[model samples]
Target chain A: MYGLIGKMRAARGQRDAVMDVLRETTGALPGCLSYVIAIDPVDADAIWVTEVWTDQASHKASLQLPEVQAAIAKARPFIAGFEFQVETRPVGGFGLPTAEPG
Target chain B: MYGLIGKMRAARGQRDAVMDVLRETTGALPGCLSYVIAIDPVDADAIWVTEVWTDQASHKASLQLPEVQAAIAKARPFIAGFEFQVETRPVGGFGLPTAEPG
Candidate 1:
């Protein structure tokens, strides 16, 4: 499985503004299976995102579009900087035990 | 599933040091079903982690332990900062569609 995980820092007091845009744009990305945003309790300005996507190609295509770029640009000012990682989990990767069918 | 997704910025030239500790300590986290660390290809010092845990209690306990604390301290110098999200996915949460048993 291919996924994107990353964190973005919101400008001193603009965290809420950034989050608003994230909530608005997530549903537009069809490739995204799950897109979650969370704030750090200890550091309020820190925002994190964990996303699972259909595949890298779809994700790459989504990023190249103008809509996504515009949303990112809107958030960039509030964000100090970001660190993120992209990875692929091999098929049958370990995690929650498979749920048994009822 | 209870998971932790976050990013940490490594101090200039210190990414490898932080990663080394992560690789070393993951097996010790029994609640952790998967612990992954990936570096942004575009930014060498940026590190991201996507983790899946058995539950929140187990994860909280792990964080309170001395070993984990010590590890965090060691990695802190290399890390500029972090933004992480902690979330729980309800049963049957979206994604991966379920694998068919052979």
Candidate 2:
């Protein structure tokens, strides 16, 4: 599986607002295994978004989805900056659902 | 549960070696729910370590464990630097075992 680990900084005091948009918009996406949104305890304006998709192609395809595109448009204004973004290969985990081979 | 999303940079060409140490050493820890280590596709020397613990106290306690200390000591040599570290609050997700209330 493919994974994305990244940090997004929200405009001052806007982290919760950004997270709400993320939660509301990430309802259903084809090939999405998991999409976790977390609050950064140390940096109030920072949030961590970790995603797992069936494959790189699935992840790439998600960007073109109307809902995803809308989400990006809606949340972009609150985003101040990004700290780091990394791609990963996920082996297996407890709560993650299995994905069909790509 | 408490979560940690962070990036660690290994010495040049040492990413795999560092991941091996992390996988070998993180066998069991009190209250540890998940510990995922992934390589950055774009940066060969960078690795993302995402952890989920039952609680803040449990996470703090882990640092004092002998095995954890040993693992840190063993892995420290290959560590080049940290990119970003963020603490998170995880509500729920697939594959993750439910953590007991703290």
Candidate 3:
């Protein structure tokens, strides 16, 4: 499985605007299985988006679409900058031998 | 399962310091099963932490411990602010019914 997470900042007063677009767009991504856009309850300005994709290549392909591009463009001005982190691993499902505390 | 995510900003140049403490402390939390601290590769000032705890009670109890308090005190100055988002759900497992794209 491949996961892509983006941590971004929304322009002052624009966080909800970006999330609205994201909610509208994510459900349609061809390879997106699970996607979450979580806003920090304490910091109204922070946003963290998590996406679980089938694979890295599929994810890269979706990023090329016109809609995706447009969404990014619309949201870019509101964003100060963002960090993208990607990880791929064989997740044997959740609760897999819960790690014992030391 | 109870999951708590905190998105915080590190004071200029103190990101590493906070992460260092988190890494050291998480392993000892009696109820912590999985903990991940991901730094935005694009935004050096942002940090997102994801933790899976056995339950809320267990998690709350840990916060009261002396070591945890000290760590929080030491890191507080380095934090600009943070938002906490908590969710509890029976996460049956991962990769469940990979959602189909519309």
2 against 3, candidate with superior DockQ: 2
Q: Give one digit per residue, the lDDT tens place, for model 2 in B10-83.
A: 99988877887877766557887777666777778888877888898999998998887998999899999999
The true-versus-predicted C-alpha distance at residue A19 of model 3, in Å, is 22
TM-score of 1: 0.49
Which clashing pairs does model 3 show? A11-A78, A83-B42, A94-B94
**Residue B71 miss distance in model 2 (angstroms):** 2.9
Interface RMSD of each: 9.7, 5.7, 8.5
Model 1 stretches with alpha carbons more than 4 Å out:
A90-102, B1-3, B6-102
Q: What is the TM-score of chain A alone in each candidate?
A: 0.79, 0.93, 0.80
> Could you tell me how far off, in angstroms, the CA of residue B87 lies in candidate 2 after the best superposition?
2.6
Off by over 4 Å in 3: A1-102, B83-90, B94-102
lDDT of 2 by residue, A1-102 (tens): 899888889999898778878877665588887777778777788888788888999999999999889989999999999987778986543345572211
Error of 1 at A8 (Å): 1.3
Model 2 DockQ (Cα-based) = 0.26
- Model 2 chain A: worst 10 consecutive residues (lDDT sum): A93-102
Query: Fnat of the models, one by one?
Result: 0.08, 0.31, 0.02
Report the Cα lDDT for candidate 3. Answer: 0.61
